[model samples]
Target: MWDRIEPLMPADPVRGRRWADHRRTLGAIAWKYRTNSPWRDLPEELGSFQTAHKRLIRWAVDGTWEKIFAAVLAAADALDDIDWTVSVDSTVVRAHQHAAGALKRGPKAEASRLTTHSDAPAVG
Candidate 1:
């Protein structure tokens, strides 16, 4: 997989790290996402959380992840490796006021400050 990815990645060096390659950086990113752990908790074998986090933020900004995924998917499809038979979808559930733990009695906090879709991939 890394062999396929090597040519697609930029050749720029990550600040403060001379030996880290694109494959290691991407693998570290995937490992972090798969485990859903805090960046600080990433295992040492994956390199510094700073490195992986910077890569994620950079890719998120530059759309590198989308490109990489598309390339991977294209490669898989060319090899007839994907399951084209299945479909999947999701629906958002809207709950009533009572469902929210916020109480009407307390000082109203700044509402809906959280954005679940920050840098989230679009699915059509």
Candidate 2:
């Protein structure tokens, strides 16, 4: 699956041998996202935390992940892997006080204004 991604990656420098499997690199990324931990806190067995982080940042800049996801969805649609009959639900998440950080000594940041078009609900 990652064969397509290999060519996209830059040629590795000073290649002796890759110490980590691609899955291990992916696991490190998942762990980082799931726990919202700093990359520096990643487990050593998962490989260099900075390497996994740098990969994500590079992909983000290139929009590679977005393209990969879209391609996967297209393939699934072609193979009838998508269950179009599935139910749908709208879920709203409310932010709690914990989401707000402790106060710091600084001027209040200006909030961006929300605008709505004629087809959208009116904003008061």
Candidate 3:
């Protein structure tokens, strides 16, 4: 996987501070996201979490991650390795409370003031 991903990383054009090893940094990033762990909790053998986090953010913002994913998918498809089937399990996936229209606490009073007339009973 790293072999497929390493070539997609953009090379630094100018010489300054040396970049961390691509494999180690990539491993750190993968572990952080895979485990949903905080960046600070990344293992030392994988290199600095800050570096991995920064690189991930930078690549995402600049579309490097997207490019790499697309390239990998294309390769897989070319080799007839992709499965086109799709599945959804509602029992294992749930919407957040906010997405389910749970009321936000602080804005209700302000919202009612804006909607209700002072001299009249409020209508639903």
The most accurate candidate by lDDT is: 3
For residue 111, model 2's alpha carbon misses the true position, in angstroms, by 28
The lDDT for every candidate, in the order shown, is 0.78, 0.70, 0.84
For residue 34, give model 3's deviation from the true position in Å: 1.5
lDDT of 1 by residue, 23-116 (tens): 7788888888899988899889888889889888988888787888899999999999998686677788888887975545544433333324
Worst 10 residues of 1 by lDDT: 106-115
CA shift at 31, candidate 3, in angstroms?
Answer: 0.3
The count of backbone overlaps in candidate 2 is 0
**Which regions of candidate 3 fall more than 4 Å away from where they truly are?**
13-15, 89-124
- For candidate 1, give the lDDT of residue 79: 95
lDDT of 2: 0.70
- Highest TM-score among the candidates is held by which one? 3
Better of 1 and 2 by TM-score: 1
What tens-digit string does per-residue lDDT give for candidate 2 at 1-124?
A: 5654554444444768653555677688989999998999999888898889877787678887777677667778888899767677889877775576533343442221234446887554
Clash totals for all candidate models: 0, 0, 0
Alpha carbon lDDT at 77, candidate 3: 89
RMSD of each: 13.3, 11.0, 7.0
In model 3, which range of ten residues has the least summed lDDT? 108-117
